[model samples]
Target: MQRNFEHRKVALGTCGRAYNTPCIHEHSCLRCSLLRPDPQQRGRLTEVRDHLLARIDEAHREGWLGEVDGLRISLAGAEHKLAQLGELTTRTATVHLGLPHFSHLVGRTVR
Candidate 1:
């Protein structure tokens, strides 16, 4: 049983859901059975977090505690995924873009 997986910005747990289950794909990455959360999808995840935050705020204003709670949990999970993805790639601290040091060229004459 080798399984092939594709890159997805938001993976819906379709495998676990038995036909017509209302699985909110974007908000369910953390609990997804087949979530391929890659570092390349960081930007999309960040945007999702932002959108969830706005929804959470709106829910709070509307006194919808249930909605706020659910949104908050999803928000936390997305944040955790972001942290994991963030650790995947590292930035080079010292990049040698300039020319190499040429101490031997000091004694060389122009041809």
Candidate 2:
């Protein structure tokens, strides 16, 4: 898992829930709802999203309607994952709470 996390960020996002089974999504990790995306993988995820956008555009230009639909689904999933990563950064902003003084609580009694 550690090696996968370090090296295969583009192809696989960590799934803490899955055990001893091949991915039912056939390694389409971005489109799989079970995927747990790592914020550290944001660069790779953005690349994937950009590529998907180019493919969708190409599919439209080539009149590949079925291909376009499938690409759009994957695109939506990729975008959702990107949004999750965005939220993670903002949500993890730390607010420091300094250590409490025991003296302050020493004489305090709970009612």
Question: What are the RMSDs of all candidates, in order?
Answer: 12.0, 5.4
Q: Where does model 1 exceed 4 Å of error? A: 1-27, 33-36, 91-111
Candidate 1 global TM-score:
0.56
Question: For residues 1-111, could you state the per-residue lDDT of candidate 1 as single tens digits?
Answer: 223233223442223443444666644566554554666678888898999999998998999999998898888878877776666566555777988888988998988
lDDT per residue as tens, model 2, 3-110: 654443334466644355676777788888777798778899899999999999999999999999999999999999998887877885787899977886787788
Clashing pairs in 1: none
* lDDT (CA) per prediction: 0.69, 0.80
| Candidate 2, residue 37: lDDT | 90
Local error of candidate 2 at residue 27 (angstroms): 0.8
TM-score of each: 0.56, 0.69
Candidate 2 ranges beyond 4 A from true positions:
1-12, 93-111
